[model samples]
Target: MHELAIMESALDLALGQARQGGAGRVRVIRLRIGTLSGVVPEALQFAFEALAPGTLAEGAQLAIEQVPACFWCAACAREFTSADLIAQCPDCRELSGDLRTGRELELTSLEID
Candidate 1:
């Protein structure tokens, strides 16, 4: 799955950061994944377990933070969390709106030693 590739890339970045900081080993890796990012947390966790052998993050703990999809509803004149792709504004039933947050797949922090 694509999650394997993504997890591998995350590991690479985490290892790089640990090396840069002179960390002997990575203690933890924190990730922020938005609901609309299309990433499966379970798959990513499995991929990390499979691919982290002998790396600086071999025994690292992975913390996944789930972010909800938020949108700005012009009709409603407010922001709200989207429940689905066809996210109509709950208050005003608006069909079109601007996405404020979501679709985020980022490595927010790394705890190393």
Candidate 2:
């Protein structure tokens, strides 16, 4: 799965940062994964488990923060979060195409030793 490649990249980045900081190992790897990012959380976790062994992040905790999809409803003049591809404003019941968030697949931070 593509999540394997994604986890490999993330692990590389985390290891690089840990080395740069003079750390011997990585304690934690925090990621912000949006609902609409097209990446499955379970797949990613499986990838991490497969790829982490014998590396600096061998025992690193993978902390994923799931971000809900948010859209701006011009009709309602407010932002709302949902888990649907076709977002509809709750108040106005209007379809909103103004996406605000929930398309992210970012490695936010790392806890290293």
TM-score of every prediction relative to native: 0.94, 0.96
For model 1, what is the alpha-carbon lDDT of residue 12? Answer: 89
Model 1: what TM-score? 0.94
- The candidate scoring highest on TM-score is 2
Expressed as tens digits, the lDDT of each residue in 25-106 for candidate 1 is: 9999999998989999999999999988898888889999999989888866888898575578878888754777788899
Candidate number with greatest lDDT: 2
Off by over 4 Å in 1: none
Candidate 2 lDDT, 1-113, residue by residue in tens: 88999999988988889999999889999999999999899999999999999998997899999999999998778999988877999898999878889998999999988
The candidate 1 region of ten consecutive residues with least summed lDDT is: 93-102
